[model samples]
Structures are given as structure tokens and as C-alpha cells.
Target: MSGLKKVIIPEMPPLEREMIALRIANMLEEGSYVNLGIGIPTLVSNWIEGRDIILQAEIGMLKSGPLAEEGQEEQDRINASCQFICAMPGSSYFDIETSFAMIRGGRMNVAVLGALQVSAKGDLAGWNNPSRGLGKVGNIGGSMDLAVGARKVIVAMEHFTPGGEPKIMSECSYPLTAKACVDVIVTNYAVIDVTPDGLVLKEAIPGVTAEDIQKMTAAPLKVAADFKEMEL
Candidate 1:
């Protein structure tokens, strides 16, 4: 046996965060071409290493790198959401039309996205809010193309809203970007794989019992007996 040290358990939320990232990372295949949506999806690019995958940012940058050093950000260098950063070698730049064409043309293999709600049928609701209060008007952007065009789609988000409303549901009430497109849902509480039979709980985060996850979820979740907490 190797002389590696045994690890200690971490406290809740941060551990949950890492487990969410890891669950998504484990799905990435070598040489796969992927487009990452904003927020948590953006963080996955930083975690991937020694993988032959190519990362495509929707804002016209290919082979996008992590945020650059304080003084290294160039005015013209930006990511999918217009965040400034340094570009990787062999990076390509183009207009949104061309970039979106790559997504819609079926050249990409996967798309990692963040969502507000995901239904049992694999419908996604993330681009807009249907409520009355004025909030940031969410745009569909390339989400429509990417969700439908990619061979696989992964959604990373917390399990529930601050008000404790479950994001995973029997049916999404908000407008959907795509129908039956999501392949996986990674949340702070568990890693779930989407199936025709509803969400499959593949891994429950440590300290968060399986019963705890099921109780918090809006839809009936099927748990795998071999479930384990995801490792980053």
C-alpha cells in the first residue's frame, strides 16, 4: 500500500462546493470539445488537467485560461461573460456568430452550464426569471444552441434556493432553453445523473445523508446504494 496520509473530513458547504466541481470534472472525456457557460461552469476549466479536452468560451475565445495576474489582463482579452483574462497559446478569436455556429453546427461534444431549475424530463430553466420583480434580464445567449447541439450537457448548481425552493423538480415552471438535454446535475448536496425515470442520485456529499438529499429535492430522486461523496 502507498504511504499516503488518510484525509480528514471538511465542514459542510465548501466540501459540497468541491464535490459539485468534482462530479462534473469526472464526466469530462479526453479529447472532448466543450463549451462552458457562465459561473460555476467557468470554474471547471481551472480544475481540468492532463486532459486532452479543449475549452471553448462563448464570448469568442477558444482555449481560454484562468484569470490572469493583476497587471496581465489586456483590454481586448475577455471570456464568455466579458471577464478579462489571458488567453492560452493557440487560442482563437472570432465573432459571436462564428463561435455560435461551432456550437450549433454540432462540432462541440459537451456543454457545462449553470441552471435555475431542471425538471424530471430534463428540461432546463436558467436564462430567464418569470417572476414579477425586476431582476437582471437573463438572455438565452448561446444556451439554446449549446444545449441542443452538444452531445452531452452538464448543469452545476446548488441544491435549493435560499428560500429552500428545490431547483430539481417534477417539472420546470420557467421557460426552458432545451427539452431533455441535460445529462447530469451537480449540486451542493449531491451528484445526480439525469435519466428518463427522473434524477438518479449517483453520489451524496459527505455529512449530507441520502435521506437528507431526497427530502430537500422537489422531485422523487432514486438513490444508488454504492453512492459516495464526490472527491475533487
Candidate 2:
């Protein structure tokens, strides 16, 4: 807060959700091997339409296709992540052992995941939001493993809950994916980077100012001097 100054929200023509996806897509690198988790993570692959990147799914496949065709989803050849997919030519399948081996062996460059809560300290909480269910809990799947194993862990999520609760906080109140594993967080409201000092507001969505974003977040955040709303 001390390093930030109040500024007007820039104008953005598109919806914040689309803006978030566009912003997250900018983080991808050529030739990087990546895994996209469900929800927002899935949308990222679609955003990277022409990028020459290799996609991996946790279920045990490499170079998976964007999304499955509308009526051509094959039950047998689906990626290990199981989001309903087709494989790219030359895409190969392996057993779960090899699949998890890629994740645990640090062969992955990045992993984009969806989170229910992420702390300012970079701890992730996507698997257990008690409010969403009773005795049964959310699935961690390979999220914990990927977050720890991958070189970069990017958390993609909407800025707030339907009830207007902030997803980024000073500390997570739910089950953790990993401590200090998240490198960045892309949300409908803002694009933030998790640093040792605090959450840095790198880009805010149009119609939302730095002050507005700070008010919405549970944790205190820092805004860059040249901060501006992301442009698609």
C-alpha cells in the first residue's frame, strides 16, 4: 500500500474473464511443456491458438490436442487429465507410472491450475473449500505434486466468489496444494505475481483501479508504479 498510488481503472472492452485468459496466455513460452488443470486452466489451451507449444495431461499423455471435437471424443484415447481430449499427431500415451513420473521427475516446465484460495505467501488452496461440500472433500489429484514438481506454478481463477469473497488472501483457510509453490495468479479482477514481499498487482482489469482491487483482496497488496489494466 505504501508503494502504491491511487489511479483510475483503465477501459477494457471485453469481459474480465476473457481479459484474464489473455493475460495468462501471455505468460506462456515457446517450446515449454505444460499441463492445464480443469476450469480456467483448460481455457488457457484454447487461448493459445497458434502457439507451438507442447501440452501434457496428468493422465499420461504428451502433445494433447486443444479440446476434444464436439462429437468425436474417444473414451479410450483420452489424455490422462481426462478433460475429454484428442491427441495431436505424434502425441504419445504412457502408463500412469510414467505420467506421474513426468510430473514428479520435474520434466514439466509449467503447470496452470485453478484454485479456490491462494495466499499472499504463494500457498494454494484448491482442493478443499468446506463451503462447497460436507463430508466429501475436493480432489487434490496431482495439483500438489505438479505445483511442487513443475518449474513454474501459475494459479488461474476468478477474482471473487459469487458472494463477492476474495480468492487471494493473506493466508489460505482451506486445504493446501503447496506452500510457496505458486508463482503467479491470474484472476478476473487482476493479474498478480506472488513475491517474497507480498502480492504485486501487475495488471488490473479495465473498470477496476488499484485501490478497488486492494479493497477486494483480503491480503494487503503492492502495485507497480507503471501499473495499467491489461489490454487484450
Instruction: Write candidate 2's Cα lDDT for 1-232 as tens digits.
Output: 1122233333444255555666778889988899888777877777787787888877878998876778987888665456578777789988888988898899899998899889999999888777666535667788888988998999989776665577788888777888999999888777889988888998876687888888878899999777887777
Residue clash pairs of candidate 1: none
What would the per-residue lDDT of candidate 1 be over residues 1-232, giving only the tens digit for each residue? 1122233223466345555666687789988888888888877876686677788878787877778788887888887677787777778889888888889888889999999899887899888776634455667788888989888899989877644577888888777889999998888867888987878888876687777777777778888767787665
TM-score versus the correct structure, for each prediction = 0.86, 0.88
Ten-residue stretch with the least lDDT total in model 1: 1-10
**What lDDT is reached at residue 168 by model 1?**
85
Off by over 4 Å in 2: 1-16, 132-137
For candidate 2, the lDDT comes to 0.80
Candidate 1: where is the Cα deviation over 4 Å? 1-19, 132-138
Q: Write down the lDDT of every candidate, Cα atoms only.
A: 0.79, 0.80
